[model samples]
Target chain A: MKHWKKILFWGLAISLGLVISLAPMPVKATSSNQKLFKIQASRFAFSPAVLAVNPGDQVTIELVSQDVVHGLSIDGYDLHLVADPGQTASMTFTAGQAGSYTLRCSETCGAMHPFMVGKLQVGGNDLLWRAAGLALLAVIAGVWWKRV
Target chain B: MFAPGESRLNLARLRVLDKLIKSRWPLLLARSITLAGFVFTILVGLLGSPVGSHNFAIIFVWIAWWTALKLFFIPLGGRSWCSVCPLPMPGEWLQNGSLLTKAQKSIGLGMRWPRRLRGNWLASGLFLLIGIFSALTLTDARLTAWILLGLLGTAMLLSLIFERRAFCSYVCPIGGFTGIYAKTAPLEVRVIDSDICKSHAEKTCYTHCPWGVYPLAMRDSSQCGLCMECLRVCTYDNISLNLRPFGSDLGQTNSITRLDETLLALVMLSSALSFSAVFIGPWGWLKSAAYDVGSTAWWAYTGAYLALSLLVLPGLYTLAVWWSQKTGQAKAPFKRLLADYSQALLPLGLFTWIAFTIDFAFPKFSYVLQVLSDPFGWGWNLVGTSGVSLPSALLGAAPVLQVGAVVVGLFWSANLSQRLVAKQVQPARARRAILPLAGFSLLFSLTMLLLLLG
Candidate 1:
């Protein structure tokens, strides 16, 4: 190969690597796992799927995915973590807004993938929350294989 | 001594027929595996739901099968997939459902008038579109699954409406790419006895070509689907699957005209660029934004990316050829000569594909594979790893094998180009042909850049 071609090849390779590695890391937003929450990252169920946390409260989500890999992504927040089998990835993010938030699985699981979801009803009456939890649990248990 | 209208079986055709009759086990195995894989891919895409991560597996299957056919079988079998492709099953059965004995071969749809549009161009264009689509929606499992089902459906519809294998010949992009790339394949179906074919009457081989490619046109061996319909139907039985030199029959007679050759070269380069932008470009942020914001801008970005990827590279390549010829003091007629030799770039494109597999397909060096698959999660997963870390032995072996394959592929292409040039150039002044060879080298360099960057 000619000298110019070799130079061009190496230049492109080096620059690409530098760009990927040198890109600034994302800023860490306020998180309350000081407000601890067990994120059951299993197939078909998010154990304790409904969580009601006050605004500015930092929440820690401990992730577990039973089958394949699952991702815990709460849109509009910085809780994007992939939960692998037998491995739990924890992400800490605060509930900065006081609106109803959706917790959706970022990674693809089989069949009803789009429907694998949970809801975080922020600053609601505690009584209505309990009833929704009971119903969500029944659906989860029907799909979940784990006895607990 | 020739009987006027009587058909006779000759030794060459007899050999091919006897092989086809006896090779049922291999044929059956090939059909069963390909059909099962095709069915399984579609089912998984539809029922299980496709996601971004699983698209890699789909790509793996698609690229692996394509590579296997183009690199190894094209030279060997000659459109052998047609004999065994599962796509034709639904159409054939629909035309002659279940009652095998009563069903006639003709569905009585009379021949449609030959339109000015050629089938090969359509087939190639369609394949190019699919390839671009696959790369863009790489992560969308559902989309991948839908594309698979859609392609199969299109093939069935076309086959049902048109006579013979028009779907395979004209519409399916994969088949089109295969037909072109197969030119470089070393194995070909050939007449074992020339004397036998010349003497035989009632030309069954010419008439029964399932893809409707005339046997006389077998000089352009790249286009032969190797469906073996001619072999099966020939009374003379004169064809044999012979191991010939790569591109041997491609240069024998011209099928792809100069203009067509230039268009194909453009298609190949643009497709490669389009693929690379996703895998290697700075569009990662935009891609993430699409998923996050669900903005309409994502769609526009994707469209622009594809247009640039599939169209720009080839356009630039043709422009370069024109510029090079003009500056090289070559006139319009000489420029046309350069364009004719551009068909030689087909091998260069195939070489790019080989290099791509070497760079991207090899699992050990692929960082993305480590992030996605959890191999130990499944008892005996065909794809995936126990850990992200590579085993030295495996990693060492893969790149070595891949580079070796790339080197071998380059040499194969170079040899093919030489033969093609020899055929295109006038016999007396053949030695003076230099400009196109330089163009080929430049294209090859660009391919290497794309591979490395990929």
Candidate 2:
């Protein structure tokens, strides 16, 4: 085994790991995009299923319950907002993560309570694209290594 | 260069490990505990809460055991779980008319499995059946119990009618699931020297194997159940519980491939993709359609499910192989190429499942603990822990875990696909051949990443 090649492989692997961890959140935003989303939560469905906001934005979500009691808890954003029937609850947080975070129903709303989900995209789901790049790099590296 | 089994570290060489495997008592004990637990789970499912999370049957079977089976057992031990699988316990005992050892006379008719129904065709069908009804069967406690009961009854019936473990070898979806991915695991049971086994006049190992695997012909870990019966009955002391490199059986030049096994691999891939979409995905319409059995929505869901698994996914894979053949200008038949290149799907499928299990079970892990205190969910807190639930185990780390797992799988698959192509074509042609598979794998990995994180 070539020590330099081994070092290169580990370096590439570590780079991929770093890319996955920090891909979604890129360099600190120079300009912030502020946006407010009023999402309707009803019967295991979220209105405007995909909410897109740029990174470094003051994102405020006004969660309105059309029926029953529901909660909005973003996976990356720890703040959770709950709304009773016909009521609205709001949560404001800085959109720091750039990946797609699932907004799940924190409270049991119905039979499909466990699966109540919506997507929160801050900037873009750059992880997917970065992952794709790393995947190709991996294949190329593998082929090159196997040949050598 | 080390030969396949030659490179393997023989665990059976250690006296304690050898003794544990050679003795019948250890296996019997494991089977008994799982069997009793299985029976109890059935009873509880019949007489338990309608809510899925509170029900022991749903929690343990779908979330707990299913998660463990994918994330731990299959990755670590191959068919190690099958060694102590409880569904075959009673039937196997009846077949041999003995609990611990093989009887002089057996009860089964000793008939052969139908040749047409052999291979993974039946197993794939059985797996699709489970996949299509997964919503109802996974959630409803009574339905879950009935499915287990049905599988038990079928295993017993098959054991009585056929020679040995025919259901597991041919019909059990979980068996097919394990058997197909077992090649990726590090642990394998192989003959130390095939010549030794062939020379021995009394091949007691073959007769004793419940899976009917002749150790001499065991080229891979795909068929052997890791039962250890061969180890005990090997008069020549030829059987070796070899710990080899992970995925040591994959992409082998001498390995045999078949259309049936290839289809099984595709079915597994499709199942993982479909499951990720349905179970962990935020699509309410899909979940509702899947759960509402016999409804119009469900019919549509079934159609989409079947089409995804049967037509779309398999069609893409076939196209990849066709592309590989066309580009490489290989002389092998298209059908043969399909079988050979399909090895790329195994690592991808296995890791996809591990990621899916992580997403599906992380939040519901609380259900496992909650049910432990109240198996029947009749407001009985036997351990004073009922209604207590923990937060999601991985929390925000799940996406990271999911992404990491998928990337590793894609890398492995890419590596394997290149080697598989190189086995046939010249280096230049191999490069062209590998492109399509790499593209296919990369595309699939992105889709999964999108589902998991995007």
Candidate 3:
């Protein structure tokens, strides 16, 4: 409970947390490039479920419905597309936001309609890595609190 | 620094609070309201739209009630929901032969729950049964209604056969869920003084408790339903509702741990992991398999699910406990030690569910509003805001929040594990003894993180 020690531990914690969150990831980006994804939407899934792209890249998606009616909406971005069976709809947008966005089925497909989702990885998914860092810090802090 | 659940701020000292708890009117009123809601949910589930999101029974029951149970009720108000739970209300009314008072002409066989069937095995088994088919139950509105009907029927049947709240004590999975996690909530109902009880002739609290928990014998908040019957019935003014720190009943070395309760905790943990995989992960084939019950793929899914819950997780936890015992060289019997230490898993398991709620429930919350306006999805928009389908408000913060919640749980469990080992092992070996348990917690946390956000 000493103020100095507590401050020191927290200082280290905050610094480590910031570093983990903001530090350029090893796989972040070599160069910005155009990215295109032809995503197939079925009853409850998107083929190539995860789409990886660099931040600031021009990203275009060609959404194709394999069966039934399906739609794709990217979370954190105002982009949506719907297609009928054996039809194609496309949308083009710049991948301006970094981190991960979930791709959800906008249309009510079937039983597992709510759960049909994919991931849009813009950069290195720094949030997850930062969270992992913070988790480690939480354990250290917990153990340290008990010890001191 | 102090005894578990010992640090007290007696909430009963507040006059308004005292009155609220003492009166039967408030509890009766609350239970009546929930009973109405429960009946309405069953009706809507049976007669409303088949779609999960658009149905009141599906959205309100699963999304709203289930989420609230995990995030708020169990964590903040231990067994408080049980105090006003409508599932037992119908039977309780029949038992009392009145709405808000004990009738002279009571109804029931007044038989005791079999000692052989005592403990949480039935509750955990019921939870496993429900979880095995969660994909269907969670999605199909009719199935949800049928399940609710079945639960109500059983509660009523047990009330007539067994004495007091036997369905709640030994049957309801939801009750079991709350009872175990209620240990971490910072509230408890206990006697102000034990000598007062000993000096008194009539033990009103024990005689009146619906859950059959004797107030003086109660060591934790696990069994107490917070009914306040004891609080009201006691003339000596001996019962006190105290506010204490979290983890108050957790990891106390002196308390005896029931194998059933420990197994319940493990089952809950396994179920959380399973839920994350089946519900949150983007595995369409797996989801379809789980939903398509009785198919070869579904049988495969059930096998894997059973193996994980009944065998893998428990086996792994046992191995970890055995390692801790070997390294610490503690003399306690293996099952006793396992049960005792399993209390550490409470926060871990609870937080996993909380994070799961964040992922599974938070995004679909708009559906709560949607269903409110259109309960049956029969095109009658009562609120005029029916067409509004806003995306997740927590879209950006959900992952960060989920991660924070999970790690905090791991931190709590890790800290508790260390303390539990320190009580048994020498200070020099305490860290080593706790390593296995710590590793187990970390592994569980990481797996959840993977399923939730990876």
Candidate 4:
């Protein structure tokens, strides 16, 4: 209700709008991090199960489905990419943080499609500090509740 | 100020806005606009246009209705949306051209059917079940599609049975939410010239009420849907819709009297709590149980889910009261007070649910993207070519935001209990309500934190 609060609210709203609308693109020099990764969406394997990338590094993923069409959804991130059979699908996004994440198959590919999962780990991001803060808060609350 | 069934009321002497609303044109205008909007939404859904379902306009309609009902209804106008609801489209159609009218009239099921068992919690309960199922199964798109289909079926089936737009008024969780919140809206239809109503022998409004509610007993805002049907049927031009302050009826006695409404309030609160706990928990086990096929440990998982949903949360409040009584505390009935307290959280829970839908559900699976891709003639791309790695910091903040929501919800419940008990108990007794409420909120939050940590 305060003037400053209104301004801050609008500022945050605008930034959120921009983030949701704009697709993540290569920000740094493209050639420096131009490594292509092949992800074959076959029966039970995703070829290279583990992918390693660096912060601010641009990488292309070429995906082809050997059997049925499979969707790749990443938890904790806004990525809704899908691949179809025979046709190759590709998209470029920067691996902007350091953490292990599951690239779960969203589309019902087959009987074991639910188990068709892959991993991605990025290096160089201050994720540790935030995780620590969460842990610290939990610890403090636990102690306080016990004392009560 | 008029008592039940009092024909000579002093409502008209109160204002000039009454004189303007006595006109029939206003009633027609309001009904037409509402009907247009309702028809448009249904048509758009039937067209199966992703843009209509996915675009901002549809979301805005639901959000605006919710916001208006919550902010305006409790303090202002009651049962006002009922005046403008376009639910009896099928009934209206049947009256116009259907050959079944003769058979319907001849059969004469009549009004003698007992009104006591008229309201059912199962309608709202089914709605809640569907909502939970949708949340667990798929995100927004599938859920929205399912809701649209369900509405079509409800409209079709309800038109045939129980007579006169009964399903929407007596059933429908969404309608119940609107009816409850409409208590806070700022405008209402009242008898402007009671002298005319008194002089006229025929009570047309009573007979014409689409939902079969007696117009004379509609002094309370809770049962009134603000349909202005009474206004249209009044041959003497006695009925008038007038603008007034919000929550004007809150302090007034004889507000809402139905036990079914109390049941509805309980259902709303429980559904909200169940949704928050199940979807936003900190236990990896819950997620595993939900998403992982083999994680189902049969009875243990099923029992825990049932106990948590139906018993544990509600039981905690009951237990608190038992504790209070054991400590030699004299007070009001705990069950009734808990019911009222939980109902107060309905608005706050609705707000959080909307936020969750927007924050987590909307951005994830968008039908709009799928439709837009169709123009390029690329049918379905079902493979993940791009790696997914959102920052942990952002992902980690979600559980905390959810915790904040739960805390706010609990405090609101506590405040409602205090208000309800103000007349029956001392301030100390009223304050006792906060302890149990806050404890439950904290417990739920910590359980969620553990779920997230896993």
Candidate that scores best on DockQ: 3
TM-score of chain B of each: 0.75, 0.97, 0.97, 0.62
**RMSD of candidate 1 to true structure, Å:** 17.1
Worst-scoring 10-residue span by lDDT in model 1 chain B: B1-10
Best by lDDT: 3
Q: Cα miss at B225, model 2 (Å)?
A: 0.8
lDDT of 4 by residue, B1-454 (tens): 3435543334444555455345545655676787676555444433432432232223333334444554344334456555555555544445323321223342212333246545545555655555444333332333344565566467546655455666666666667766655544455556665666666777888766656665554554555666556765677766655555543333222333444554555455555444433444322344334433334442345455456545665577556545544332545455544444444434344434433433333222233334333311134333431223234345435434543444344334344434443444555564453445435434543443333222
TM-score of each: 0.62, 0.93, 0.96, 0.56
- In order, the Cα lDDT scores of the candidates are 0.52, 0.84, 0.87, 0.49
Please say which candidate is ahead in TM-score: 1 or 4.
1
> Measured by C-alpha RMSD in angstroms, how accurate is candidate 2?
2.7
Candidate 3, number of clashes? 0
lDDT of 1 by residue, B178-294 (tens): 666676666566665677777777677776565666665455664577655566666665665555555654444343344544565556655654554433232434333333223
Q: Could you tell me how far off, in angstroms, the CA of residue B305 lies in candidate 3 after the best superposition? A: 0.8
**Every model's DockQ:** 0.02, 0.47, 0.60, 0.06
Clashes of each: 27, 0, 0, 31
lDDT leaderboard ranking? 3, 2, 1, 4
| Model 2 error, position B270 (Å) | 1.2
List ranges where model 1 is wrong by over 4 Å: A1-148, B1-29, B52-60, B63-78, B95-105, B108-110, B193-201, B252-258, B280-283, B286-311, B320-339, B364-393, B396-433, B450-454
TM-score of chain B of 1: 0.75
Runs in model 2 lying further than 4 Å from the true structure: A1-36, A54-62, A66-68, A76-98, B1-5, B254-256, B391-393
Report lDDT (Cα) of residue B38, candidate 1: 76
